[model samples]
Target: MRSSLMRSLHAAGLIDYYALLIHPLTLGSGARLFEGPAPLAEFELTGSVTTSKGVIIAYYARH
Candidate 1:
């Protein structure tokens, strides 16, 4: 459901930018940000930052 809505919004050019914060730790398994069986979307890297504790913050914009 969420993936379908995201795909629709991106397809209609409604999404201009998005950001993701990646942590150093990891779980054995978990849900991903993007889901569903659709082809992967394209995005441009705008900026990024690495915290003192090693967390990574990434910014992205529509291509």
Candidate 2:
């Protein structure tokens, strides 16, 4: 799934930028984006967008 792909990319040091679509809902419990122990990496929020459905698409670039 998407988490696997993201984890792979992160492990391989291939994630330079991220575009995450955040839906406007909480399921009470779910998977974490950066799960478990990981090296500290900094990212700067470059931009974002709020869709008509209240979904937020956030853009970030590794710093």
Candidate 3:
């Protein structure tokens, strides 16, 4: 992430200000209803929290 930010800064030329976006990943599990199935973790992905910054504001969101 730092590398990417650095590259972008360099490309933009003297980036004194920057907007950053962060994301949080959440996963859920379901109890095994059948024995012939894979683990619940692999079966489903639960919630995803994402962050996006605009102008000068940063926030997180679920997508």
Candidate 4:
């Protein structure tokens, strides 16, 4: 599963940069990213952008 893989990557300290895109619509319910029991990882905002349609693209790097 993707969640498991992400968790493993987090545990191994292999993630340097993580980016996520947020749309204007909400799903109400669906798979959530970054869901796990591990401690919260600190990330610094590297960059971000918004499209004409209102979609936000965010970029983050581990701190």
lDDT values for all models: 0.78, 0.87, 0.38, 0.84
Mark the regions of model 4 whose C-alpha exceeds 4 Å error after superposition: none
Report the candidate with higher TM-score, 1 versus 4.
4
Clash statistics: count for each candidate:
0, 0, 0, 0
How many collisions between residues are there in candidate 2?
A: 0
Off by over 4 Å in 3: 1-8, 11-13, 26-63
Error of 4 at 35 (Å): 2.7
TM-score of 2: 0.84
| Deviation (Å) of 32 in candidate 3 | 36
Model 1 stretches with alpha carbons more than 4 Å out: 1-8
How do the residues 1-63 of candidate 4 rate in per-residue lDDT, one tens digit apiece? 387897789878888888888888977987767675676788899999999999999999999
Better of 1 and 2 by lDDT: 2
True lDDT of residue 44, candidate 4? 96
lDDT of 1 by residue, 4-46 (tens): 6877886676888887778888789877665655455678999
Any residue pairs clashing in model 4, and if so which? none
* Alpha carbon lDDT at 44, candidate 2: 99
CA lDDT, candidate 4, residue 46: 97
